[model samples]
Target chain A: MALSTHTTTTGFLLPSIHSAPPFFTQQPNPTTQSIASEQWIRLILSYARHRRLFTLRVEDAETAGNDWDEVLRNERINRRVLPSYLSAIIASMAAKNVAAYEPPKQNRSALLYWRLPEEWAEVLHEWAISTGQLNTILTFYDITDPPIESPLTNIPLPLLRKAITILAKTNRAQLIGVADGEGVRFFAGSK
Target chain B: MHRRGVGLAAFDRQEQSKRSFAELSSALSQSQVDHLHSQLSQFRTALAHFASTHRDSIKNDPSFRHAFQQMCSSIGVDPLAGPRKGGWWAEMLGLSDWQYELGVQVVDVCVSTRERNGGLIEMSELLRLVSRLRGVMGGVITEDDVIRSIKTLQPLGAGYQVVDIGGCTMIRSVVKELDEDQTVILAVAQLNGGRIVEDQLIQQKGWTRDRARAALENMLLRDGLCWLDDQDEEFGRSYWVPSAMQWDI
Candidate 1:
């Protein structure tokens, strides 16, 4: 396949190394591999943030399989990241606390943490106060998929819960658990 | 007649100063010879004191050591002759032997690794390899020290030079000089992870087909930048720059 440059749907330009064939393969040298893995992590995190994608499956993204993710596979270059290489990259990311394995033990899927839980809490708190949603109860779904325009809209529910937990720690927000679902109420001037 | 007389007097003065040491010694009285010996001993003591004080700086700082060598040369001293051959100056500053040893090792490393990197290795990578080769036996070699050693290698016409390619300081052997076109191609290849195709060069650099082909061919055949996939018709011809190639090990 012919190699071509890839850009995200939101127009985030991928680095030129993305089109290079060797980038998809695991570099043999430790120093070169370290640099390559760093670039890969930066690319993956930025692409995930741009698409607002929280979860990534290693099989779908890295290997040649039925459910192939375009971000990890370049058809024109005929280079798909080997599963072994992808695992190495993911292991490095986990070590650096940039990502956490979903289901903890399986290590099949990863939750990409482009922003730490503390930073996400600040984002949600800012949105709540600015949108006049303070002092009112918001379900996990409401904060993640708000009806009105807000920064928290479309945020994954599990990630939203982590953020809410941070706010509860500071007494800036209170979590209310009902039979059906969980909700959080934000307090004013939690800055 | 007056000008000729003055010229003759000036020539006589020049001859007096140029007299042989043996003739001057024969002409001097016993007391004068003793006074001259004391003065010469005093000068030697002062020079030895100066050299001993600045020994560390002379060993580490290149420019300071250069000026010190110049001063030594002006006084008819050979500071680099080693402790055995060179009398006091060599014993005062014992850096010449270390510099010579390091220079030889640098040449060895460059020649041995030339086949792999085509005599072009990044400064940091070269230092790492050289340090590993030395293995705690040799003293630490800094970038400035390496440059100084490479400077010493220049007189031999070995063509060892530190070149700046794509913002990286690379050591290139003078065995093969990369012309402007080959250098440009190498710079472009560096951006693409050491792999470059004829069409990419033409498109990115706005060069005609012939110009790109000629440069690539020169680099491949003459410069030893390996050509990849020459047999594969699908990928066309891609050139791999040995220095730019990120080796796994």
Candidate 2:
């Protein structure tokens, strides 16, 4: 059992199947590394979507006690997994319009929720209709910014921008800019 | 012997660990064994890399098979004849993988050292020759376009050798030549010893048997380069000898 342990966001511990040091490291063979990185990037995006998470803070993993953060940072795997390798995958995805980057500063982490804002906007529409909030005016920040009353609250600002644009296109919502308010507001279209 | 699946890692591992014959042979010098080992290592590495990198394509390519067979022969191992039983060295070299293998379909076309015009036939010359041949007549030709007509001639036991310089190349093949009953067949048989069949003249020319036969016989006789094999009922056959007629096919 050379297996390493990983903890999922839901707090379930599981053995890591892809725990080889090379799995974490960027491949010295550029071609293989690129392919592997693509696979990893896809997997990471899907995982984030499933967990409904955005904006992963690498440094806060110790405090948050999430297993993936710790597992990803393990010295054996991280030795080859350079920031550049991850960045390349992110950039490629962005160029294809498959995913966009929320560039990380010193303490900020990336927010990659594989589903784009347009998709989220659709989900929001369905949720609003089903939950009986259509044809209502709501603060934009109220929907996206969170007290976690709804699952959509956890979505990051980048995704919020996409969602707003999508809603505006269908004449489903109007974004009204207001001065001296805590956040923006939207008026839903049609019943 | 249990045969494990062969892969790059396994091949590399075996080559790295295997002991050379020089180690066991008391009479052989160490330096000789060391040199042989180095070459073997290089060959193994190249083979492993190629096989892994081009696994799918090689499986589909006939030329790749030919090249692999040639490589196996160069390694002093007949792919058909399995290694000697219970030999550690044989096992290390992956002899089992090739054991009980069917012989590779070998087709070679030998071209003469002279017929290639001192070895400088340009692509235009090859294209012109192919264009004259029946199937490719007026057909578009490209460097990558397959020489299909030549491949078909393999069953007739025709093959080709493409010379980069000015000499002729031989194509040894297993294809059947068009019989006299079907249509007229004309082959400019070279006078040299290797039975170099020059170019195939097919289609409308293929229908003109008597003319084709007469043309071949007259050309050979006039050039004094080759003697007709008048007995064989197939296409006009001849034995060409150099220094007599210059066969321009």
Most lDDT-accurate candidate: 1
TM-score of each: 0.49, 0.36
Rate residue B77 of model 2 by lDDT.
Answer: 46
Runs off by more than 4 Å, candidate 1: A1-10, A62-68, B1-242, B245-249
Off by over 4 Å in 2: A1-17, A56-68, A75-80, A96-98, A103-109, A145-148, A178-191, B1-249
lDDT of 2 by residue, A1-191 (tens): 13345655565443342343334534333444444556566656666666666755444333434524533444433322345555555555655565655663342356665776767887777666656666665666767764556767766766776787787787776666545442333445653
Among all windows of ten consecutive residues in candidate 2 chain B, which has the lowest summed lDDT? B101-110
How good is the docking of model 2, as DockQ? 0.00
| Tens-digit per-residue lDDT, B1-249, candidate 2 | 166548888777666545544355544666688889999888767766766566555445668756776876897845434444433223433333222111111111113312212222233434444444423554455433323434433333333433221133322221223234211211232222213232343332343546544554443444222223321224334332221223234
Taking chain B only, the TM-score of every model is 0.58, 0.22
Per-chain TM-score, chain A, candidate 1: 0.88
Candidate 1 overall Cα lDDT vs. reference?
0.72
lDDT of each: 0.72, 0.45
